[model samples]
Target: MKNFKTLLFITLMGSLCLTAQNNDTKRADKEFARFEYVDAAESYLKLVENGKGSDYVYGRLAESYYNIFNTVEAERWYAKALETSNDPEMIYKYSEMLKANGKYKESNEQMEKFASMRPSDNRATAYRKNPDYLPKILEQGKKFNVQNAGFNSEQSDFGGTLHDGKLYITSGRNDSRKTYGWNEEPFLDIYTLTENSDGGYDNPTLVNSYINTRFHEGLVSFAPDGNTMFFSRESYFEKDFEQDSLSRTRYGQLYLFKATKLKDDWDEVESLSINSENYSVKNPSVSSDGSTLYFASNMPGGYGQYDIYKATINDDGTIGEPQNLGQKVNTEGQEMFPFISSNNTLYFSSNGHLGLGGMDVFYTKEIDGKMAPIRNVGIPISSNADDFAFIIDEVSGEGFVSSNRDGGMGSDDIYTIKKLQPLCDVLIAATVLDDKTREPISGANVSLYDDQGNKVVTKSTNADGIAEFIIECEKDTELEVTMDDYESRKVALQGTSDEESPVQISLSPIEKIITPEEIVLNPIFFEYDKSNITAQAAFELDKLVQVMNKYPELVIKATSHTDYIGSDSYNQRLSQRRAKSTEQYVISKGIDESRISSEGKGESEPKIDCGTNCTDEERQMNRRSEFLIVSGGPESQE
Candidate 1:
């Protein structure tokens, strides 16, 4: 997540400092040990071309490229190494590279391999919980409202650290410095700006000449004396570096420095004792008491490329031996830019741990002296790009995060972040009406239940047959309306946002019988000449089924008719098929077959008799079906 000059890294394992018997292979190992991955990659290729390659060489070569964030080269050698070795760490690293290159399906394969070997790993556990975490990150809402800082420059600017009401930041605004190869931008320098009375910022002024260098400098944290400050600086200042023998090139690592604030500037600069020529120790953060300093480093014996470390800052200005913050806060990827808040909560940015996309800001508070699970700050503060260097004023609930995402003036930019309140719940409402008369039914009991059948709210319909409810957004809600003699009805309610729509419920009257001689009802139409019963026909048949069930001693005869369009025999067969289908459908709904019979009227008994000169409407009327109760008629039931 931390990229460019700010990020630091080391080999996957300290034990990877392999010494080969051959001089050529030894040369490659030394280059990798010195962290010259580009040169080491070439040296390793020479050994493989010269027929002296092994899984150890390939794995270390892959790790060399990985440390440089060269995922393409990393994946190549990792694949080659897989032919010879099955190291779980190799699989994990390969999975990360594959995912970085957008090969998620293959990455999951590698992750499964790693999980089978090391099932207890936290990374494995996180992957098992969510093999698809990208969408969850994309779906997450913005964690903070962000805007541009008044003091942002027209070049790469980031790392906003607030100290004594003044904001110190890192920038590549100085064109005088050499262009850094990482982004073809000028090397970084420390800049300071004071807050204006109107919540604006004064024009930034570069820090005192002594505290900066021709290479790069990161953000800073000040001690209680305000004179003592600690920050990240490139080791080139003192020629503290390692040389690649094969290429005759020197690479400087990152180091932490302590400086004293003189009048209007910072001076008395001195590199910390923990600074190493073999590895990087950068990104400094200080406790409020100034007795402890937290930083990120790639020193040997750490859990990963960059691990958070803590050191005791003694009164003599020297620091105690740095201790790795432990695996709980470190992983196999970059974790840097730590800030210890006034309340002792440790906040940092990491890509090694599970998070949104790229580098996400995370916080962990001490619980009984142990750090809790690192919680992501989420989006708006984090993104799919580099998001680091988060510091805040807890009282104001305002902070700043550095990012190289879109809309930036340069490579990386600092944004003012403010926390906002969450949104409100959805409103659900319903209306009840009589089914037959289509009239509003007042004083009806309406109950709302969630998808789990838990009752949420209950109310009676008003004079307008409306029952309103305010509820939280859930998967589905059932709105039930019931009256004394009408059958109860329920309607489902659902939405994606805080929207309200009234559900219309119609309760039918529980009538047991209809006109027995000629039951007049809504027509149930069928598809052209088809014997299959339609849903509308089934609904009409349900009324008969309910009536028949109400009076068990009832017997009914169904008669079907058709227009005179086809041959008489064909017409007769079609009508008979319709009659049989209706009879079968009724019997399927629990009606006794022995108590029901059917007949085909064909074109003989037409409801609208116009001979062969019949209009389409007359023909439609002639094609119909009727049900008559022979035994338990309406008069008999009455």
Candidate 2:
């Protein structure tokens, strides 16, 4: 999708719709139906200039430019076409143009209109479900910390490669060159940069003129030794391309060329033998050993418009036939800018797969002699605009990526990428012992909970009374410890450290009381609207578990309750699930299921009479799990 073709005579998806067939419009119809979009666009503009333009002519012109990805012109004509037309598809296309130009609010307006017209369409239904999705997309998770490269320009600068303290990039910074019809920008050229010790960059200078022509040239990749370089150039430089007979148009394809870095300058620039007159070959990404060359192509036998293809580098320097990366990497749409890391992971950009609207960067790693599922690199790296050419240093966790997102110095600017530590990485190490005797409590139950109150892991203390877990170092890591006739203990671990310290806990022994009254143990609390036992709750439950184990014939009943946030029926269902979960946990720890029964009290039995006006602390008391002795005490079951 980034190639930005001139669109002379393209391979059409199918025959285009035609409304006029007179001699004047006959030439335009043939060009339009064949998907000669640029030629079609030119002819339609001529008709408009001659005062013979109609709704069909204006619509065809918009569709032609849109197909060729000229959003600037497409937006102009789509606006004109929609003034009197009600075509739902055009509305969707208009929305796409508005989005590509960063007019998201206007885009959503058209999208909502289209969704109302075609309520059954999946794309429309999806847009209607979540029209304001940008904030959520941005907040998904941080994959990279990014900032503008110091050596960017007000033109399209992209395809960054770092080698030996120097940055090699491609850009349209040469204003002396002729403008490209696709984006109305200067043709691409290669540029290099060297950094100074003071963390500043020397101005980016041009590569050798022989390697860069007035035609498009960008995206350079080099060998590990920096002696050999493979890069993309326009096919017009080869002087062996074909032209369409009817249109008499010169079609240019992007091809890969090889050059060697010599003493003072690069020499012996030669086109790769795999160059074809019909298909494109660009975006070269070579291996560190120079044994494998990965590039993007629209050649035959590909699975998509532009698929990532690799050719083996032979010992004698000859190249093998290109191999498509297969359906796992290539889709029915475009895939380009492949980078094979030193660790053997393939990173590429894709638009066919599900993403956050435009091209999102995805990575695929090999496992067991096959490619694994492709994973989106996630937000802060990908956006609604085109994001590609991603590379990262796996060791230092710093690299670069190219994006056309808003607030850049150019249409496509290179952004420096850096990796930061995850939000959490705290390890939990806990120990349980008697408070007075200072003796280790063996086989004591311990549970770990994350900051979100999720039961992450559960383990029992060993002979040394230790339970350790490596978790995301978070704000509120809770640990629970309990033993027979001992007061339940709960401890919260919170700090940041590369090394974790053991959370030592001590429990006090409780006096044995023989009474006919049931002992109301402290409330085993849960997070809001949750049923699973937390680390704190687990500590309290373990006490009852130990007491029941001592008195083998003892029976207990657990009643769970919820606050006034939900409906009566729903809260009853939720509390029932909570009670069942608690009972199951006790049974799993060597207790008989028949000795434990559970019931849901819902919000009807709130001990805090504050009711609906209850504070969070008061609500916490309401959402409780209580245990009562039913039998095997001095008294019988009621």
Candidate 3:
């Protein structure tokens, strides 16, 4: 009877302990899901102390530390999680944490494992392509000379934007306000540092009392006229929130708000039409022209967790539909804090694209209304910890960026950025046009060649008839322009000083008469008594290649003729060589060999028919190659 009672007591205690653990797990999970990471970490730590460690628990614990930017704790828990968990994302995050802790080699080892597991992932592909990218990034040297902005507090302070002699920023130094569960910091508020007479910033002050609410608010963007403003704030300001299931823990999203300047202070504060209760819309940046509004959101139909989006700011001060920046500018990870410069370069922060780690600042210019290739802004602006909120001025070569990198005054601090180098080594903007019409010509190929005549770079003319190139400034180069049915033009690349002038190229259309039987191009001229193709001949032959490429099924016969200046046999041999050369050249330009046939007509099919008494001009016309469309003709796919 005593043994039975002891066994029953032991079993009951075990049940009670399991129930308590289960309750703790549920609470921690809920806190984590609601982004209450500080509380979640504490609750999860209790589980670890009670010997209830699991792969899932370890992963959650590591993520909680990572979200709060605690690299040491995150790395420890991640190492524990990786002992049993094979999740690729967890491994990737662990690698990032390792990097933050200065364990690059270990991070790379884990990244290699991650790449093998998920080769198709963008992060994995980027790692595979440039596994040793860190040294190269450091070797590229610093583009920006950085310094502490000097207004940092003991708490989180970031998102600096300079406008009209004032530096605007977000700060969590309001000790009186409620502390956020994510970081245990006071709610964010907008503050500005006014420029003093000595050209340095003065002490910080709240931009407006109403704009600084009890909930989070900051990251302000002003219109071009400075009369209007756009900023981010928690939806809680309008009593907006969502209750999550039975827990009923209220969740508030960041929403974009617009306000109008009423003389000394901003008034008429209202949320923008793009704001929604389902997701977040923050980090507003108005274009230089104020025609477009750029922002970041995690709204539905996005390519990733959060994506950079843009909307047309209509003249009536209403926003059009928000359009995602697409895969080139966005990824399957978070992209946020978009800032558009005066030169149309869009700078944003993302961890998704190839970077040093965490959220690195990247820039892409708008080319012909499309986003150009995204490029990392490089070291000093990026780090292993969260680095974001980049803003710049093209003219001044000065800017500011927010970072949580090592040796910072607080969790996030603002740093001043001075560009160390000029924009592009040498910038050339070339414009192609028609010689006869003098109108902008689109779809023209513009190529840059060095002094040695080696082709350097080539670009197709955009809709604006412009092809821009950034090349070495000191080297002498040549610009060559070519089009389908136009004469090729070459001009020497001239060096200019500070002032920029567009290089204009005019090309004459290839004069041709297309008949049902044969396509007659401008006379193909070779040096006198030679069968080799000349530059002029090559130029005219390009037109034939275009026509053949356009109509793949078209078959042409090349027949060469010569003047009556030489013996019959000699002229026949020369014509034969010329005809074969023409056929071979066309084939070399990606045309099918079976589609073209060649023959030598000698002087029998001369256009002039002047015989031995022909003048130089008439004889030149007689010496030509005729493209006779035998099977497929112009009417098929013209």
Candidate 4:
């Protein structure tokens, strides 16, 4: 009996030790899943340090180290895993890591080994299509220490809005009622979190029963007062309730719900008048003043699949007509999730234009009643993932964006972004001059180049004959100035400083004349039976102003001629008047009148033989004015 008891004690101790070891491994796996890669790697390293380095443990350790960006440690464990096991998944991942680390020779060998082991697997063939596919952006994002907000776990939490020291995030977590039809995703509702004294967030609580329905709701925006809320909701009641429902409406629609603070609590949720049955609207954005509402919709007469529309808030708190923003603001592809910054600068997401793929954030400004060209906020804030639903604190440059890239809890995760100061201060200013006089030349192209010889910024000279580009210059920089028909001048500044000092550049005008081989002008109109200039003649004269503006050094002569339908003296007087009218109109349009000379050729310069009996059209064609390049101006021969 004593001998049997000693054996049982030994077996029981061994079983307890094995169970503890398995529990540790599972804890490490959970840590990795939570994106605590360094902690997971430390746990796996302990197992490796002990005499328990199995192939599975080694491979998992390598992945954890890779996530932590410890390439050296990752490579070491990957080699151990390859030596210990013939797992196809392990081999494939190891090969990819090797390729990413530029160990192509060994990477190719491992890939061949994986391919040979699984001949029927076509993943290797598909991967070869984009062999250089490195998720560089995602790899960098993993370094950011993002913490899960500890909201509902089983639902997707995204599209957070910070207002009045509280955070509101949308989630699809299940509700207690459970009466709502399940969407393809979990049921979504808005939950609010207040800020703690230590700059951390408190436990999230449901905002109100009025706003938290058991249906899909997300992408909420609040007015400046925080009393009015706009959110997206999808209703499938027509299809989900009916017995033979065939409704195909699966898209989200925008809804405005009013929440008034009454007795220290928000009460009475009601929809706004902007909600329409004709179109689906989502992603509402109100201007800082709260007078205009901008939202994304797929209504007719839009530029693309989805475009941003604006509706004015009437004095009586009603919405005006929905106006399409036109092609200038909208594109041929979907543009959504617009957010108006404090300065009224419009920021939105677009998938139509050139980008890193998925939706990229673009910003535009409404200046002088027209939307300026949309500018992409490049790099860092944007990536190849769907980086959208971003909101920035007006006072601070701190903002948050939602992305589904790797290193997140699951699905989409919210990331905090803080803008750093300008990298380099390159004071790029240009002084334009008259080439012949060596004076200032206005409206010339001044561009800045980086070390890679790519143009970074461009600006044209202002009316003061000075063009300035406040370039954020780094070490090695180049500046280039170009003008029409002129030799482009480039200056390389080595070791440029990031100081506030300015660098002035000079641009010489072009010496050569680039006249078109054939010149055609729209026929000038005249009063009936009269050859005098009219307001209609000002249209052709404006074209001459444009030509003079582009080619400042070219001189031209305006010759006016009349057909044989009138007397010689009358034709000469009319021709001279016409010539003076053209020259005077050019001067009025801001062109230097000295660059043009007028001549009256009367009936001598007719292109066709038009007698007194000719048709009105033929006579009108002969009674015309023409422009010819006479000579080079002061700067033309520079």
Clashing pairs in 1: none
As a TM-score, model 3 comes out at 0.60
| Candidate models: Cα lDDT each | 0.77, 0.77, 0.82, 0.66
Error at 509, model 4, angstroms: 17
Residue 132 in candidate 1, Cα distance off native in Å: 5.7
- In lDDT terms, how accurate is model 4? 0.66
lDDT of 1 at 63: 79
State the local distance difference test value for candidate 2.
0.77
TM-score of each: 0.47, 0.48, 0.60, 0.47
TM-score of model 4 (CA atoms): 0.47
Please tell me which predicted candidate would have the highest lDDT against the true structure: 3
Candidate 3: misplaced stretches above 4 Å?
Answer: 1-140, 425-428, 434-480, 489-501, 508-638
**Model 4 segments beyond 4 Å from truth?**
1-152, 175-183, 235-254, 422-638
Q: Model 4, 431-543: lDDT tens per residue?
A: 76666677665666776655545455676777766765444335577766666544355677675544344555654433232344212456766665543334335434545
Better of 2 and 4 by lDDT: 2
lDDT of 1 at 514: 63
96, model 1: CA deviation in Å? 29
lDDT of 3 by residue, 1-638 (tens): 99999999988986876676567699899876655555687889998998987667888899877655566788999999889679888899888777756677788999999999999999899888778766655654487898888879889999878777778899998788889889999989999898877666768888776688778897999899998999999999888898789987889899999999887788999889988888999999999999999999999998899999999999999999999988989999999999998877789999998788899988777655566657777888888888899988888988889999989899999998999864323557899998888899999999877654545567899888999875543457789888877756679976543324468898876544456788678777666665545445765677788777766788999999998988889988888767866775676567877898889889878898787789999988888789998877768765
Please give the clash total of every predicted structure, in order.
0, 6, 0, 9
Looking at model 1, which ten-residue stretch has the lowest summed lDDT? 6-15
